[model samples]
Every structure is written in C-alpha cells, then in structure tokens.
Target chain A: MQILEFLNTHMDMVYIVILSVLLGVEVISNVPSVLHTPLMSGANAIHGVVIIGAIIIMGKADPSNILTMALGFLAVILGTLNVVGGFVVTDRMLEMFNKKKPGKSKE
Target chain B: MGEYLLEISYLIASVLYILGLKMLSGPKTARKGNLYAAFGMALAILATIFLYVDEEGNKLQNHIWIFGGIAVGSVVGWLAAVRVKMTAMPQMVSIFNGMGGACAALIGLIEFPHYFGHGGSILILLTIFAGLVIGSVSFSGSVVAFAKLNGNMNKDIRLPFYNIINTLFIIAIFAITALLLVGTLTDPMYVYLLALISLAYGVLFVIPIGGADMPVVISLLNSFTGMAAAFGGFLYGNMAMLTGGILVGSAGTILTVVMCNAMNRSLTNVIFGAFGTGGAAVGPGGSGVEKSYKEIGVSDTAVLLNYSQSVVIVPGYGLAVAQAQHVIHELEELLEERGVSVKYAIHPVAGRMPGHMNVLLAESNVEYDKLVEMEDINPEFETTDVVLVVGANDVVNPAAKNDPASPIYGMPILEVEKAKNIIINKRSMNVGYAGIDNELFYHEKNSMLFGDAKSVLVSLVAELKTL
Candidate 1:
C-alpha cells in the first residue's frame, strides 16, 4: 500500500518523462550534421546526470556496508569522468568552430 | 523551504539543458551552449551536495569518499580531454560514454540489494533491472567499440549462428526480466546472473561489427547509455536527470539513424549483417576485364590543380591516418592565393565519426564554411574543374551508383565523377575499407596521384610555390 501510494503521488513524473522525450527529439532534430560530433559529445555529458543518483545513494548508504560503499564510490568516479570529460572535450571541439579566421593557432 | 530550493534548482537545470541543446544546433552559438550545459551541471551538483535530504530528513554523509572520487575523476578526465588528439576523438567519446554507462550500472548494483531486502514494489524492481541491464550492456559494448576504434581490435569476430544465438539470448533476458518483475524469480542471485548475461551480450553484440560500421555502432551504444541513465532517473524521480537522459537518448538515436542512412543500411542490417566480412570480395570490375588507370606525378598534379578555376577536396579516414590535415590546409591556402576557389566535400560517414573530417580540417584552421556536406557539394561537382581525392576512396566511388551488383550500390556517394577532372591521391591500387575496387579510379577523367597523403600534399604545395 505504501509503495502504491508513492507511485500514485509521483504519476506526474511519468508525464514529465514522456514530455521530455518529445521535447528532446524536437530540439535535437534541428542540429546540422556539421555539429553532430559535438552535439553527441554534449549529450553524452548531459547523461552524466546519473552522478546525482550516485551521490544520493552514497550519502544514504551505511558506511560499514562495503559492497554498497565500493559501488557508490566507483559510480561517483565514473560519473564524474563522464561529466567533466564530455563537456571539456565538447568545448575543445566547438572552439575550433568559434574561431572564424584561419591560421589563428595550430595544435 | 530547503526542499523547495532543491526542486527549483532542478527545474532551472532542466531549462538550461534545453537551452543548451537548442543553441548547439548553430555553429556560432555552440561553444556558449556547451558552457551553458556545463554551468547547469555544476548547479545541479552543487545543489544536490548542499540541499538534498532523504525521507528521514538526513543530510548526505561520506564526504571523504564523495569529494575524493570527484577529485580523482576530475583530474583524470580533464587531462585526458585536454590532451586527446583530434583524430582520436571518436575513441575518446566512446571511452567517456562507457564510463557513464558503468556509473549507471554501479548505481543499480548498489541499490538492488536494498530493494530486494525490503520487498520493494514492482516499479522499483523494474527500474533497477532496466538500469542494470541497459547500463551494463552500454558499458561493455562501448568498451569494445573503443578498442575497435583505437586499432586495438581490427578484425570482426563472429561465431557461427551468431544472429540466431544473439536473438535467443535477448529473448531469454527479456523473459527473465519479466519473471523477476512478476515475483516469479525471488532469489537475489538472479540479479548477478542477469548483470553477467547482459555484459556478455554487450560484448557479443559489438564483436561481430566491422570497422566501417563503427560510427553506427558507437551512436547506438551512446543511445543505450542515455537510456540507461534515464532508467536511473526513473528510479529517483529526479527532473534534471530525467530531462538530461531523455535529451541524450533522442539525440543519439537521431545521429545513429543519420549515420545508417548515409551508408544506405538499416539499423537491423547494421546490427546483424556483420558487414565487411568474407575478406576482400571481388567487385563487378575486379575480374574478366583489365582496367587501366593513369598515374600522374606531383608536378603534373600541381599543374592540373593550379590551372583549375574551382576544386573540391574529398577527405576520408586515410587523410586522418596520414596526418595530412595541416599540409592539405597549406595546399588549400596556396591554391586560394592563386585565385583558385577550394572547398572540402565531406561525406556523412567520412573519417571515423560524424563530422570527423570537419574536426580534423578545423584543427589545421580550415574554415568551417568551406567544409560542405555531401548533399550540397554533390551538385557543385559538375561545375568543379578538378576533384582532388585525398586519402578518400569509397565515398567518391561511382560503383555506389552506376553498378547495382556493387556491394555499395544504392548508397549515396560524393558523385565526384561528375566533375570535369578527378585526381585521386592514393598510395596504390588498393581496395577501400569495403574491400571493393572503385570504378572511379579507372574512369578516363580520373588520374591517380599515388603517394602518402602528407608527402603528396607537401610536394604539391612545394610545386605550387614554384608555379
């Protein structure tokens, strides 16, 4: 009954999920092919939002429960890598496009 | 009040994410878009750290582990992103995406036991299983894709009856997941079994795919990672996580479809076709007829290029392999100095990933406006005086059009043969990644400039200097 009650209260979450999917599709379909790599990279970074769930679980987990702690720690690390690495790499890629004049710099 | 603040922050974060993606569509606003998304991420992380409260109204503990993990991850991620070469961008994206998938899988692993112990609801259990299976598959599949892209694994490994076996494995996974959701399978050990099977499926799924199909595979796995993250969002009912996951999921799916369309292959064909197998099969022109090609030296190529009023360069993975981007840019500049207009024709699946040639050419300071997509540039080829094919083969191959018997038939190509003259710079008379002879090489209007791409461009630049 408690779980059922919880689900009933959060039915809006399901609606949110559906609407978000539609919005996401609409927004992403407009991206040109020239920006495909950067956009993919950016989206990859966005999904690093799983770091939130990782942090939440880590916060509430029993410190003595080694399995939970280890998994939580690893999740945080990997999620951070996804977040930081995805954005930075995307920025580096987009930097090439922002500079209009050729022969400005070379890597 | 604090809870309200946390919820508001999530709402703001979601808006910023949408704005970021919208801005990302344009070249001018793309960097700002990335920064906006980064700022949103930073806001979400900070809000969660300071304001999040559980059902029991307790603040998050384990600061040591949380901060330490973030520090280690940030340093490693930052250094890797900063130092990665433009050519390695595909594999780098693969590896980073794999990490995200692994993180989501780990969340499921950590949470499954707690829910099982408490006799959690079907919805919670379904969310956990969904996250676990999808996340683990994305993780392992992306790792395989990374290895394949990085040249660590070149050959496709297909077991006998792989398609049927894979189909059955997928069905079994689904059946087990259903049983678990319905309370038919109560044992906690099934969780481990499910995770293991999912990981194995991921490896098997990617192992049989050939190199040329990597862009599609990577895009598919990228979408898988996004969906896994979305499942994680479902578990927590977090708005920002859900929105981000959905956005990525849709974006990756569109990209995968675009990549597959470029090659004229369906998703099912890409997944099960195990293309690029059979080892260099003979093409329609490969046998029964002796095809002759004209070879031109550097000076002649330069002369042909210099006298041309308009030229289009078709770049492929071979260009990246030879690191000829900079020299090619030099060639372009020299040609422009002589009043010859130059532009690059980029195939959708050129290089290794989408827009890969653009990135490579951009790194050497090739203007983005000069990099034209296949659809737009194909029409211009007719008016082009010369089509300089540099380290590119299959995209310009006319077999994709004129020969139905060709493996690449019906696929859209650059239509470079429509140009007045075609000068293909290649190392030798070798077949491309598709392992088929390009009929374009034997066309009368085509002349082969044979050498390494970098050296060829360098010599051409030198020859142009004297002209």
Candidate 2:
C-alpha cells in the first residue's frame, strides 16, 4: 500500500524512469546504418548540455554553501569541456569533406 | 510562474533536436545538424536549471565541486580531442562513450543511498541498478574497443576457455546485482565492488572480439552509453534525457545490424565467435595457384576495358581512406557512356565501417542499383569480362577460397579473380589490415596498377574518356 502511494505521488518521475528504460532497450538491441554516424556525433554533443545543466543546478544556490558552489564550478568546467570536445569532433568529420581527389592534375 | 518559461524552453530544445536530426540525414546538411543539436542542448540545460532552481535550490549547494570537476574534465577532453588524429577518431569516440557511461554510473551510485532511506523507492532503485549495469558495461567494453582500434589489444587474444570465464564473470555480476537489490549488500563498498566486477565483465566481453569486428563493437558500446544516459535521466526525471537516449540507442542498434549484414556474418556469429581469432586457414598452394593469372598495366587495362562486354568495380576501405569513391563513380559514368554495362561490387565489411563504401558512393551520387552487395555480385564475377579492384585487398583475395592457411579462409569474398581479367589498383606489394601478403596481386590474370586509389581512379576515368 505504501509503495502504491509512493508511486502515485511520484508519477512524473516514474514516467521518466519508464521512458528511459525504453530508450535504453532501443539503443542496445538494434543496428544503425551509415547515415546515422553524423547523427550520433550530433547527439553526443548533448553531453555538453548535461554538464551545463549540472552546473546551473548547482550554481543557483548560495555561494556560502561551499559544496554547492564547488559542484556549480565543476559543472561549468565540464560543460565547457563537452562543448569544446563536441566541436572538435564535428570539425574532424567535416575534414573528410574538404580533401580533393588524387587524379586532378596540377598545372 | 517560471514553470511556464521552463516548459517553453524545453519545447524549443525538442524542436532543435528534431531539426538537427533531419539535417544530419545527408552529408551536406550534417554541419547544420550538429549546430542545431548543440543549440538545443544549451536550451535544454538552461530550462532544466530554471526548473530545478525553483524546486530545490538548497540541495544543489555543491556547485563548487561540480565546477571543479567540469573544469578538469574540459581541459582533459580538449587536449585529447586536439591531439588525436582523424584515423583514430573511432577509438576516441569509444573512449568518450565510455566516459559518459562512467559518469552515469557514478551519478547513480551517489544517489542510490539517498533512495535507500525514507525518500527512496523501488523505482529509483531500479533506475540506479540499470544505470550501474549499463554504465559499467559501456565503460569496460569501450576500453577494450579502444585497445583493439589502437592495436594495443591483440586481435588473436582469445583464451582457450574464454566462454567459460565469460560465463563465470556474468554469473558473478548477476549475483552481486541481485544481492544489492535484495538489501543483502547495502554498503557503498559493496556497490563499488559490484560496479568494478561488472566493468571487468564488460572488458572480458569485448576483448575477445577481433579487430575486424571493432566497428560493430563500437556501435554496440555507443548504444550502451545512450541507454545509460536514459537511465540517468529517468532517475532524475529528465525528459530530454529520455528522448536523446532513445534516439542514440535506436540508431546504434540499427548500425550494428547493418554492420552484420556487410560482414556477411550474423550478429550471433559476431558476438559468439569473438571475431578475429584463428578461423579457417588458407592452404599453402593457394599462393601458387594464381601464378597462371595474367597481369595488366594501365594501358592494357584501358585497352581491354575499352572493348569489354561488362565491367564491375569493387571498392574497399583503401578507397574511402584515400577518398577515391568519387573518381571511381566518374570512371563508372565514363564506361556507361561507352555503352558498357558497369556495376559496383561491394563486399560487406569492405571499409572501416559497415556500408562505409556505400556511404562514400552515395555521397558522390552513384546510382543505387549499380551498388551491389557481395552475395548478389559474386556469381557474376565468373562471366564478367573485367573486374576492377580499387584499393581493395582481403575482400577480393582468392586465398579466402583456396588458401587453407589464410586468416580469412572461408570468409565469403567477391571472386573478382575469376573474371576474365582483374585490374587491381594498389600502392605496393603490401599486405592489408590482416598484415598478410595478397597472392592475388601476383596472379597472371591480375594486373597491379600501383598508385594511390584516388589518383589511379582519376587517371582511369581520364584514360577511359580518351578510349
């Protein structure tokens, strides 16, 4: 009975949980075609967002709270890292497009 | 009051994700997709912060630690990305995916104890467990993948009793997880140990896989990371997390299937075979069998194909790495204008990734029907007047058929050597990724046009125009 009540009150959280499970299952069970590599790379950029979210959540608190302040700082740092890393990866992928084929004659 | 603002932000973020995905569908728009996705993530992060601040500002007082961690991670990530070469991009990706999984697992660990108290519930517990399992596997599996890609891990490192050891480790992981769930092991130390053991199991799971199978392994690990992220989202009641996680997971799974098809191997064989170990061997006589095969020069190939009834072009990773597909397509077009029937023969696992060759061809607007898989085109090799192998090695190696000592023996390959004449574009008498000499290069029927794939293909196309 207590469990059921807990579930009702936390229905929104439960929805998140269920959705996550479904997503996870989808990720591991299927295969992807070549077209999806760039998509995956793009999605990976979301890691930066996660870092940003973690930062803001921690940052809005009182600076006097040293631990919270530390977490906020960490979030910012990680978020920056995520952003930079994602851009570098995207750049490298783009490099594949820039190369000229070998057969073109040089005057 | 601010709740509405948060909702609106989420909506915008979701739209960005959709647009980003759509843009990513084609090569030309891939850059736009990346930018859109990044922008959406930024929005999502901002909205999440707004909502969380409104709800529980006090609990998030550990901002300092978060910031410090972020700073350290960013510097390291930046340095790694800048230093890594493009050739090693796949390994870098695997490593990053592993890190993401580690982060998700760590988050779950930190929150698991909180849920154990009055505030804790079964739903949270399950989420935590899921995170731990997925994260641990992704972490270790990715490490092994990294090793394989970099050649740090041996491709032939299969243990005699690998299955037995793997079984034992899996059992141990399950048992520990069960104990933790049942409250028989509530200590943080125990949970940490469980994570460690699970990670070890993941490593073991991937180490036995051969280098040829690394692409599939990379895709599988990618999915694992997505699932871990989704679980983390569920634990925290994050909607964007769920959606992004689903997208990655589904995409990864599909890629794995495509890779399996390309290799002409089943997923079961890939997983259970611990691919890359000793398989059927090619015979000693295989190398000598092709001695009667004829060799052709560039001019000879030009002359022969000029009057050929039909021609097939087979491409491999060498073509992609050399960026030669466009030229090959051009050559094909040239042949078509001459009233020659031309088609591309693609061997599954021809390139670094599954469908790699296909993607390259597609990028050049090569006709879809001209792109043929190995199974569909191998039979045509016998009757085909000419087979042009551009920077492809192992896939068209006749040793796979006759050489019992060959590492790739029994692996299905295009019988390009069976054609009336075979012209192979190569740089040297060098072996392929498997590091073994190709006997097909010396066949009397096979002519080696030594040069870069792109350069040779371009010359061929140009030469074809003259003919």
Q: Would you estimate the TM-scores of all the predictions?
A: 0.95, 0.73
* Model 2 ranges with Cα > 4 A deviation: A1-34, A46-107, B26-31, B54-86, B113-119, B281-313, B319-348, B355-386, B397-420, B425-444, B448-467
Expressed as tens digits, the lDDT of each residue in B1-467 for candidate 1 is: 88889999999998998889888878778889988999999899889878889888998899888888889889999999999998999888989999999999999988888787587888898889999999999999999999988889977888999989899879978988888888788898988889989999999999998746887888888888888888888888887788888878887798788777768988888888756565444476477898899999999989988999999999998899999999999999999999999999999878888788888888888887789999999899889999999988878878788787666677789999899999998999988876778888889999999999999999899999999
Model 2 agreement with the true structure over A1-107: per-residue lDDT tens digits: 86799789978766654654454344333323444444455555554344533454455546686654553454455445545566567555644432222222231
- Write one digit per residue (lDDT tens) for candidate 2, span B11-54: 67756765665666565566667778778876776566445543
True contacts kept of 1: 0.74
User: What DockQ does candidate 1 score?
Assistant: 0.67
> Cα deviation in Å at residue B317, candidate 1?
1.4
Q: What range of 10 consecutive residues in model 2 chain A has the weakest lDDT sum?
A: A98-107
RMSD of each: 2.6, 6.1
